[model samples]
Target: MNDAFGKRVRRLRLDRDWSQQELSLRSGISTPHISSIERGKRFPSLEYAKRIADALGVALVALCDDASELRSPKMRGSAEELPLYLQNFVLNEEATPYLEVAHQMSQLPKEDADLLSLVIGLLVKRRYETPVLTP
Candidate 1:
Protein backbone atom coordinates (compact mmCIF):
# COMPACT_ATOMS: atom_id res chain seq x y z
CA MET A 1 0.00 0.00 0.00
CA ASN A 2 1.31 3.42 -0.88
CA ASP A 3 1.36 5.47 2.29
CA ALA A 4 1.04 8.63 0.29
CA PHE A 5 -2.08 7.33 -1.39
CA GLY A 6 -3.58 6.46 1.95
CA LYS A 7 -2.73 9.90 3.28
CA ARG A 8 -4.43 11.48 0.33
CA VAL A 9 -7.58 9.44 0.94
CA ARG A 10 -7.60 10.35 4.60
CA ARG A 11 -7.10 13.99 3.82
CA LEU A 12 -9.90 14.06 1.29
CA ARG A 13 -12.23 12.27 3.65
CA LEU A 14 -11.51 14.70 6.46
CA ASP A 15 -11.93 17.65 4.11
CA ARG A 16 -15.50 16.52 3.53
CA ASP A 17 -16.13 16.31 7.29
CA TRP A 18 -16.47 12.55 7.00
CA SER A 19 -15.39 10.04 9.55
CA GLN A 20 -13.97 6.68 8.53
CA GLN A 21 -17.34 5.12 9.24
CA GLU A 22 -19.09 7.77 7.22
CA LEU A 23 -16.73 7.24 4.31
CA SER A 24 -17.22 3.50 4.57
CA LEU A 25 -20.96 3.91 4.47
CA ARG A 26 -20.79 6.23 1.51
CA SER A 27 -18.28 4.13 -0.43
CA GLY A 28 -19.74 0.77 0.46
CA ILE A 29 -16.46 -0.24 2.05
CA SER A 30 -16.33 -1.54 5.59
CA THR A 31 -15.20 0.66 8.45
CA PRO A 32 -12.32 -1.66 9.29
CA HIS A 33 -11.20 -1.69 5.68
CA ILE A 34 -11.40 2.09 5.50
CA SER A 35 -9.39 2.34 8.68
CA SER A 36 -6.78 -0.03 7.31
CA ILE A 37 -6.50 1.94 4.11
CA GLU A 38 -6.18 5.25 5.93
CA ARG A 39 -3.58 3.80 8.29
CA GLY A 40 -1.60 2.43 5.35
CA LYS A 41 -2.03 -1.10 6.58
CA ARG A 42 -3.74 -1.98 3.28
CA PHE A 43 -3.84 -0.64 -0.24
CA PRO A 44 -6.95 0.11 -2.21
CA SER A 45 -7.50 -1.63 -5.51
CA LEU A 46 -8.38 0.52 -8.49
CA GLU A 47 -12.02 -0.42 -8.14
CA TYR A 48 -12.03 0.45 -4.47
CA ALA A 49 -10.29 3.71 -5.20
CA LYS A 50 -12.89 4.53 -7.82
CA ARG A 51 -15.68 3.78 -5.37
CA ILE A 52 -14.14 6.03 -2.75
CA ALA A 53 -13.46 8.80 -5.24
CA ASP A 54 -17.03 8.63 -6.50
CA ALA A 55 -18.38 8.80 -2.98
CA LEU A 56 -16.13 11.73 -2.19
CA GLY A 57 -17.17 13.53 -5.39
CA VAL A 58 -13.60 13.75 -6.62
CA ALA A 59 -11.69 12.35 -9.55
CA LEU A 60 -9.83 9.08 -8.97
CA VAL A 61 -6.54 10.74 -9.84
CA ALA A 62 -6.97 13.17 -6.97
CA LEU A 63 -6.85 10.35 -4.47
CA CYS A 64 -4.10 8.30 -6.12
CA ASP A 65 -1.55 11.11 -6.46
CA ASP A 66 -0.65 14.67 -5.64
CA ALA A 67 -2.35 16.84 -8.23
CA SER A 68 0.22 19.51 -7.66
CA GLU A 69 2.83 17.24 -9.19
CA LEU A 70 0.94 17.57 -12.45
CA ARG A 71 0.26 21.29 -12.08
CA SER A 72 2.08 24.08 -13.85
CA PRO A 73 4.80 25.92 -11.93
CA LYS A 74 2.48 28.80 -11.19
CA MET A 75 0.12 26.41 -9.48
CA ARG A 76 2.72 24.49 -7.51
CA GLY A 77 3.07 26.39 -4.28
CA SER A 78 4.57 24.70 -1.26
CA ALA A 79 1.88 22.30 -0.09
CA GLU A 80 2.10 23.69 3.44
CA GLU A 81 1.33 27.17 2.12
CA LEU A 82 -1.95 26.22 0.49
CA PRO A 83 -5.21 25.52 2.25
CA LEU A 84 -6.33 21.90 2.11
CA TYR A 85 -9.69 22.86 0.61
CA LEU A 86 -8.20 24.96 -2.17
CA GLN A 87 -5.60 22.32 -2.89
CA ASN A 88 -8.25 19.68 -3.21
CA PHE A 89 -10.49 21.91 -5.27
CA VAL A 90 -7.76 22.80 -7.74
CA LEU A 91 -6.76 19.18 -8.06
CA ASN A 92 -10.12 17.99 -9.30
CA GLU A 93 -10.15 16.83 -12.94
CA GLU A 94 -13.10 19.09 -13.69
CA ALA A 95 -10.93 22.01 -12.59
CA THR A 96 -8.15 21.32 -15.10
CA PRO A 97 -9.43 23.57 -17.81
CA TYR A 98 -10.11 26.27 -15.28
CA LEU A 99 -6.55 26.07 -14.01
CA GLU A 100 -5.18 26.11 -17.52
CA VAL A 101 -7.28 29.08 -18.50
CA ALA A 102 -6.24 30.81 -15.33
CA HIS A 103 -2.63 30.22 -16.31
CA GLN A 104 -3.19 31.75 -19.73
CA MET A 105 -5.01 34.67 -18.22
CA SER A 106 -2.16 35.37 -15.83
CA GLN A 107 -1.52 38.64 -17.56
CA LEU A 108 -4.80 39.89 -16.17
CA PRO A 109 -5.21 40.91 -12.55
CA LYS A 110 -5.47 37.95 -10.17
CA GLU A 111 -9.13 38.54 -9.27
CA ASP A 112 -10.19 38.94 -12.88
CA ALA A 113 -8.28 35.84 -13.96
CA ASP A 114 -9.82 33.77 -11.20
CA LEU A 115 -13.37 34.92 -12.00
CA LEU A 116 -12.92 34.34 -15.72
CA SER A 117 -11.52 30.89 -15.11
CA LEU A 118 -14.48 29.98 -12.93
CA VAL A 119 -16.95 31.17 -15.58
CA ILE A 120 -15.10 29.29 -18.29
CA GLY A 121 -14.97 26.16 -16.17
CA LEU A 122 -18.70 26.24 -15.54
CA LEU A 123 -19.43 26.77 -19.23
CA VAL A 124 -17.08 23.98 -20.26
CA LYS A 125 -18.60 21.52 -17.80
CA ARG A 126 -22.13 22.43 -18.87
CA ARG A 127 -21.30 22.17 -22.57
CA TYR A 128 -19.81 18.73 -22.19
CA GLU A 129 -22.69 17.34 -20.18
CA THR A 130 -25.54 19.08 -22.02
CA PRO A 131 -27.16 16.91 -24.63
CA VAL A 132 -27.44 18.28 -28.16
CA LEU A 133 -30.94 18.38 -29.56
CA THR A 134 -31.44 17.00 -33.04
CA PRO A 135 -32.60 19.41 -35.72
Candidate 2:
Protein backbone atom coordinates (compact mmCIF):
# COMPACT_ATOMS: atom_id res chain seq x y z
CA MET A 1 0.00 0.00 0.00
CA ASN A 2 2.93 2.29 0.65
CA ASP A 3 4.94 1.65 -2.48
CA ALA A 4 4.80 5.32 -3.41
CA PHE A 5 3.34 6.58 -0.18
CA GLY A 6 6.74 7.36 1.25
CA LYS A 7 7.76 9.37 -1.77
CA ARG A 8 4.45 11.19 -1.69
CA VAL A 9 4.96 12.03 1.96
CA ARG A 10 8.49 13.21 1.27
CA ARG A 11 7.27 15.39 -1.61
CA LEU A 12 4.46 16.89 0.44
CA ARG A 13 6.71 17.53 3.40
CA LEU A 14 9.39 19.12 1.25
CA ASP A 15 6.76 21.23 -0.49
CA ARG A 16 6.00 22.84 2.86
CA ASP A 17 9.68 23.17 3.80
CA TRP A 18 8.90 21.30 7.02
CA SER A 19 11.56 19.37 8.84
CA GLN A 20 11.04 15.84 10.05
CA GLN A 21 10.97 17.13 13.63
CA GLU A 22 8.19 19.57 12.81
CA LEU A 23 6.25 16.76 11.14
CA SER A 24 6.94 14.58 14.15
CA LEU A 25 5.55 17.21 16.49
CA ARG A 26 2.52 17.75 14.27
CA SER A 27 1.91 14.01 13.75
CA GLY A 28 2.90 12.83 17.24
CA ILE A 29 5.17 10.25 15.65
CA SER A 30 8.86 10.07 16.43
CA THR A 31 11.41 11.41 13.97
CA PRO A 32 13.14 8.06 13.60
CA HIS A 33 9.84 6.41 12.68
CA ILE A 34 9.19 9.09 10.09
CA SER A 35 12.61 8.53 8.64
CA SER A 36 11.86 4.83 8.29
CA ILE A 37 8.61 5.58 6.53
CA GLU A 38 10.22 8.09 4.20
CA ARG A 39 12.96 5.63 3.37
CA GLY A 40 10.34 2.97 2.54
CA LYS A 41 11.78 0.76 5.22
CA ARG A 42 8.35 0.45 6.84
CA PHE A 43 4.72 0.80 5.99
CA PRO A 44 2.62 2.95 8.24
CA SER A 45 -0.38 1.29 9.77
CA LEU A 46 -3.69 2.81 8.73
CA GLU A 47 -3.98 4.72 12.01
CA TYR A 48 -0.54 6.25 11.57
CA ALA A 49 -1.22 6.91 7.92
CA LYS A 50 -4.32 8.94 8.76
CA ARG A 51 -2.40 10.73 11.47
CA ILE A 52 0.35 11.67 9.04
CA ALA A 53 -2.15 12.74 6.42
CA ASP A 54 -3.99 14.92 8.91
CA ALA A 55 -0.77 16.47 10.07
CA LEU A 56 0.10 17.24 6.48
CA GLY A 57 -3.29 18.91 5.87
CA VAL A 58 -4.04 16.56 2.98
CA ALA A 59 -6.64 13.85 2.65
CA LEU A 60 -5.39 10.33 3.37
CA VAL A 61 -6.26 9.38 -0.21
CA ALA A 62 -3.95 12.10 -1.42
CA LEU A 63 -1.05 10.12 -0.05
CA CYS A 64 -2.16 7.13 -2.07
CA ASP A 65 -2.34 9.12 -5.30
CA ASP A 66 0.84 9.49 -7.37
CA ALA A 67 0.92 13.30 -7.45
CA SER A 68 -2.52 13.96 -8.92
CA GLU A 69 -2.93 16.74 -6.39
CA LEU A 70 0.36 18.17 -7.54
CA ARG A 71 -1.17 18.81 -10.94
CA SER A 72 -4.61 19.78 -9.71
CA PRO A 73 -5.71 23.12 -11.14
CA LYS A 74 -6.23 24.47 -7.65
CA MET A 75 -2.48 24.27 -7.23
CA ARG A 76 -1.51 25.42 -10.71
CA GLY A 77 -3.46 28.56 -11.66
CA SER A 78 -5.92 31.12 -10.30
CA ALA A 79 -8.49 29.89 -7.79
CA GLU A 80 -11.35 31.71 -9.45
CA GLU A 81 -11.07 29.35 -12.44
CA LEU A 82 -12.49 26.63 -10.25
CA PRO A 83 -15.83 27.08 -8.59
CA LEU A 84 -15.56 28.65 -5.14
CA TYR A 85 -17.13 25.58 -3.54
CA LEU A 86 -14.72 23.13 -5.21
CA GLN A 87 -11.58 25.17 -4.64
CA ASN A 88 -10.88 23.59 -1.30
CA PHE A 89 -12.48 20.19 -1.75
CA VAL A 90 -11.42 17.83 1.02
CA LEU A 91 -10.87 14.30 -0.31
CA ASN A 92 -12.44 12.62 2.69
CA GLU A 93 -15.76 11.30 3.91
CA GLU A 94 -17.11 14.83 4.40
CA ALA A 95 -17.06 15.12 0.60
CA THR A 96 -19.46 12.16 0.24
CA PRO A 97 -22.11 14.27 -1.45
CA TYR A 98 -19.70 15.38 -4.13
CA LEU A 99 -18.15 11.93 -4.39
CA GLU A 100 -21.55 10.36 -4.79
CA VAL A 101 -22.52 12.80 -7.52
CA ALA A 102 -19.29 12.02 -9.34
CA HIS A 103 -19.92 8.32 -8.97
CA GLN A 104 -23.40 8.68 -10.45
CA MET A 105 -22.04 10.70 -13.29
CA SER A 106 -19.56 7.97 -14.06
CA GLN A 107 -22.42 5.49 -14.34
CA LEU A 108 -24.28 7.56 -16.88
CA PRO A 109 -23.77 7.09 -20.63
CA LYS A 110 -21.09 9.33 -22.07
CA GLU A 111 -23.51 11.62 -23.89
CA ASP A 112 -25.75 11.98 -20.87
CA ALA A 113 -22.80 12.76 -18.63
CA ASP A 114 -21.44 15.29 -21.10
CA LEU A 115 -24.81 17.03 -21.39
CA LEU A 116 -25.18 17.20 -17.65
CA SER A 117 -21.69 18.62 -17.32
CA LEU A 118 -22.42 21.27 -19.93
CA VAL A 119 -25.68 22.25 -18.27
CA ILE A 120 -24.11 22.45 -14.84
CA GLY A 121 -21.21 24.49 -16.17
CA LEU A 122 -23.49 26.93 -17.96
CA LEU A 123 -25.66 27.35 -14.88
CA VAL A 124 -22.69 28.05 -12.69
CA LYS A 125 -21.22 30.46 -15.20
CA ARG A 126 -24.53 32.32 -15.51
CA ARG A 127 -24.94 32.55 -11.76
CA TYR A 128 -21.47 33.96 -11.36
CA GLU A 129 -22.03 36.47 -14.13
CA THR A 130 -25.34 37.64 -12.67
CA PRO A 131 -25.20 40.65 -10.37
CA VAL A 132 -26.67 40.43 -6.90
CA LEU A 133 -29.36 43.00 -6.17
CA THR A 134 -29.11 44.79 -2.82
CA PRO A 135 -32.18 45.08 -0.69
- Judged by TM-score, which candidate is best? 2
Residue 88, candidate 1: alpha-carbon lDDT: 90
List the pairs of residues colliding in candidate 1.
Answer: none
Cα lDDT of model 1 by residue, 1-135, tens digit:
468778878877776667898889879999999898889899888899888866665556667766533211132223456889978977789988866554447545569868887998899999999999989
Q: What is the lDDT of residue 116 in candidate 1?
A: 84
Model 2 TM-score?
0.51
lDDT of 2 at 34: 92
Candidate 1: minimum summed lDDT over ten consecutive residues — where? 68-77
What's the C-alpha lDDT at position 108 in model 1? 57
Task: Judge candidate 1 against the unseen true structure and give its global Cα lDDT, from 0 to 1.
Answer: 0.72
